[model samples]
Target chain A: MEKAIEVKDLRKSFKSAAVLKGVDFEVKRGEIFALLGSNGAGKTTIVKILATLLKPDGGTATVNGFDVAAHSENVRQSISLTGQFAAVDEILTGRENLIMIAKLRHLKNPRQVAADLLKRFGLVDAADRRASTYSGGMRRRLDIAMSLIGKPQLIFLDEPTTGLDPEARIEVWNVVKELANSGTTVFLTTQYLEEAEQLADQIAILHEGRIIVSGTLEELKKLFPPAKVEYVEKQPSLEELFLALIGKKEEK
Target chain B: METTKKHFLSDIGVMLGRSMRHITRSMDTIITVCITPIAMMLLFVYVLGGAIQAGTDNYVNYLLPGILLMAIASGIAYTAFRLFMDMQSGIFERFHSMPIARSAVLWGHVLTSLVSNAISVIVIILVALIMGFRSSAGIVSWLAVAGILALVTLALTWIAVIPGLTAKSIDGASAFSYPLIFLPFISSAFVPTDSMPTVVRAFAENQPVTSIVDAIRALLSNQPVGSEIWIALAWCLGILIVAYLLAMLVYKRKAL
Candidate 1:
């Protein structure tokens, strides 16, 4: 079978400045492939190309058998994108926002689909509430839920968990994993190294618009072996120790 | 084509609801659009009406149609501004990723502008009626006025969407609309084109504002409209088609 996503020598630039320089990568079907990069490393630019939002200055990409440039509408039909922020409309209710995307996608039974997604995202209780009123986690959930309206084969998540508590972030991780397990190819770009380690079946480190490294977790770990895994080795973690010392002194 | 049409109609209905919700939520914007034109009509009719040399009819009657068009022109900008906001917010990018129709987004915004402009026009007309502005035309004539206003709004809305998609700043998005707001002043909307210089008369008569206002004015007055109505519809339809094509072109080039 052909790769779910294929890119070769993809170069993107904003006028004089190049953002993505001859980047080559491919994502296997049903695999969670994470593109790790720092800010301005062209992570989002690559995601945009794959999602059919931005055209590369040079090189070409294909998503789910459709060329990103020549067959954009076809590529668009098979992929969904969730941007860095939870870009839901503030004035629209959670359900309205979902339904808007559903209707735009020409979904059959939009209301039912919206309800299912809402329930699936655990947002049914807040479905009627304006998305603005939602907590950060709820909004992000709704954002991801909106992307599923098309039943897309590939999902480009550009920083899916930028501003979430640890617990909420883990929930998103589970969701991404679940999507990959269910045969959806998840192409993710994230700043969090741990997130890549946790979720990615395959990984590529994009630095300065080039893929400096590409491998699995074990493969990546081999390059910088024994990079100081620091631990406190504390006497009862200090906080607990201090608390017990103070309590004993008080009792004495 | 059939699927596209189905998607378009569905998008229009859904977008019309969303746009109406936006207006209803902020209602102050619609009220401002509705009341500003009528207020100007009131001020012009009562304060400046006596000095104006529009025609033999009540000055209110002569100026009412212009104010109606102005109301629509002003109201339609908000639609563009709203579209701009959505574009900036990454909503269009989100829409593009879905499997639905591509043109639905633009149509949604265009139809919303038409609906809200309709409300603003009705409000202005109600105020005009209260202030002794009369129209003797029947339903067909009224429908003609509606058609003219809808086409005008559609054209202006498309024009507005261009900046909304391309502008770097919020104020920049709506800034382009200022020239549109000022257009009616130079045309026959406010004064008789015959009174202007020869050059200005040619411009004012040929530009869309004059023809549209004149067609609407003639329709409301129950006068034989002659070819002016055709010219007006042609201008409105022509501008609508051109602006729409240009906007979609520019919008396609724009990055989210």
Candidate 2:
């Protein structure tokens, strides 16, 4: 498989503190590669460098075969970054936000493109309302929709599900899965281990500005000793229970 | 190179549209921009008009140019505030990653400031007209007044960009405009510089605001602008070029 992102000995320092310490990793094209770590683990720094938003202090990163440092614009053209924040303009309506991105991308039919994305993202009902009125899930959906304007081959989701309720998180997960299934590469970072397990084709654990280990999920699991498989009856999770209870109360 | 240039213009257009929507939604920014200068204009024309003894009989005419400058200086604080909000909200990071030209984002805010400030200027002039202000200069000279105001707005808007990028707090982003708002008082905007103390007169005569105020006042009354027009142009252009370069430098550091 072709590599979508390749980084070697990436290094960055902010003043006296180093944020990325010679980190190295690679992500295959059309795969969801999750960089899992705790807070302050340099996941965002790595994403920023790969997205061409920040320059590394030392070493090299290439995305979609373009050197991030030397051919920053070429790298930028192939990638989209959904930052930790939703990054939507609060005063503009959801449709307006999509149109702005579409127009900026120089789409031939920006209005149609915006309308299509709104429908695909299930935001048509709220399309004309100011984005400030959007729930966290709606805002995240819009942010992802904006990133899809130019049909970039590679997308970065930096802590995309942070602070979201489980249902909203599942909605975003479904969108991400659909993107990958349709042949788009996704590089995701999250503090939650389950999020990585749920979405990543390959997983890398970042700690203290370094990738401690990285491999395909099966390969990573194989490194552990084999144990007897066991099964137990599963009850619905808390999230499912909460939804069921809420539905019952509303019906009554 | 051609595509980059093309993208730059279009990206600026899109960004301008986005910022203008914010302005339309929040009428408070426009209202605040006009209120401060209009209040000052009223105070000077009514209370301080007779005591100050400006050369002209109608203090509104004499003071209109100064108040207009104050309006512009105050107006650009919103530019900084808006830019600061974008930075805080992470939209700048999003824009940086896109294929669009980097400078286009700053140009968006700068152009928005220019348009909004121009509106505020026209509104102040209309209010002054109601208060018995008159201008005898022909259309060409009136165009000259507009040209100067545009230059002044461009220069100050670039200055505001620096704080908008570097400031840590909302107050810090906007507080830089206080000195700018006070600058007109020291100039010949309200009272003639010659009437001031020697040191004050020297400073007021040498400052950019005084040249701008004097040039506009001359053009409004059909008086010979003489060297003040050139001086005003030089000040405006000089500040504009320097601020643009500096703002770009800070922006590159912040964004990159």
Candidate 3:
């Protein structure tokens, strides 16, 4: 089968600044491929190019077997983008936002599609409420639900949980995992190492516009010097501590 | 090509429906757009009307056209503000990445501006009627006024798209309309240009707003609309073409 995404020496620049320089990567179908990088590492530039929202300055990128540059409409037809910020329309009710996307995608029975997504995403109770009143987690879920309206072959989530609370971040993680389980290829970018470790089937670390390393979690782990066995107490991470406290509070 | 064209219009309709919902849900935007122009009409007719000589019996009659133009100017600022919000919120990017026609996203906002501005114009006209403004014009003339107002709204909305697409801040997005809102004041919208000094009068007579205001005022009064209507159309079409080109250019560069 053809790959979900393919890139070869993709290059892009803004003004005189080179944001993406000779980048290369491939994503297999039905897997969560996480592109890990710090801010300004060109992860977003690559995603934008593949999503057909931008034109590459040089080289080539293909999404779902269509050239992103030459066949941008076909590329768009195969992919959906959930940008860094939750793209839900604040003034629109969550249901309306989903329906709007369905209509734009030329789906039949938009209302039914919206209703089904609302139930699946656990947003039925908030369906009629304006998205402005939603919490961060609810808004992100709504954004993801909107993106799923047309059921594109691939989805690009750029920094999906950058500013989310720990619980919201976990909620997004579960949603991503659920997407992969259902056989959708997900291309995601993040600065969180734990995010890549937890959800990615394949991981690529982007450093200064170049992929320095690409592998599965275990493969990347082998790149580090062999670990000498040591007996040390492990402290709970802040995320674990926060979740525990929140879980206790909820139980009460 | 056939399917693409069909999707282009349908996609614009869908996008327009979305923004129209925004306009309807927040009726306050419509009221806010009307308040300034309506308030100016009230202030001028009641307080300043006795002193100002606009060569008309009812000051509101002389003032209605300019007020309509001003309302449209203020109304399109909301278009800019909404577009800026979309750009900031990433919804714009989401739409761009979709398979729908790329230009539909913009046409949606532009059409919304026209409809919302039309609503504001009608409301102000009702207020003018209540303020003792009357017109002798028949139905054809009334339709002409509607057509001109629609054209003016389309032109200004396209101009608003420029700042909407490129503004660095919310303030910058809407600030472009301030001068537009103030433009009618210096034209024949307020008082007759015959009473003014040369330089200001020269500007008042030569500017686009004056011809538009004069043409609308003539149509409403059932007077001869000779060259003024043509000049107004020329101005509107000229601005519409130039603004449409520039806005599309900006959108292409920004999106790509």
- After superposition, the stretches of candidate 1 with alpha carbons farther than 4 Å from their true spots are A226-252, B1-8, B193-206
Second chain alone, TM-score for each candidate: 0.92, 0.98, 0.98
Give every candidate's TM-score on chain A.
0.88, 0.94, 0.97
Q: Where does candidate 2 stray beyond 4 Å?
A: A228-237, A246-252
lDDT per residue as tens, model 1, B1-256: 3454567677667766776788778889899888778878878888988888987567877887789877877787687688878887777778766555667777777777777888888887888888887778999999988887877888888888888778788788778777777788889987899999999889888888888888888999999898998998898788888988998898767743
Question: What is model 1's DockQ versus the real complex?
Answer: 0.48
lDDT of 3 by residue, B22-132 (tens): 999999999999999999999999999999987778789999999999999999999999999999999999999988777889999999999999999999999899889
TM-score of each: 0.90, 0.97, 0.97
- Per-residue error for A79 in candidate 2, Å, reads 0.7
lDDT of 2 at B45: 87
Q: State the TM-score of candidate 1 restricted to chain B.
A: 0.92
lDDT string, candidate 3, A63-161, tens digits: 888899898878888799999889889999999999999988898899999999999989999999999999999999999998887898899999999
Error of 1 at A120 (Å): 2.6
Question: Over all chains combined, what TM-score does candidate 2 have?
Answer: 0.97
Residue B225 C-alpha lDDT in model 1: 92
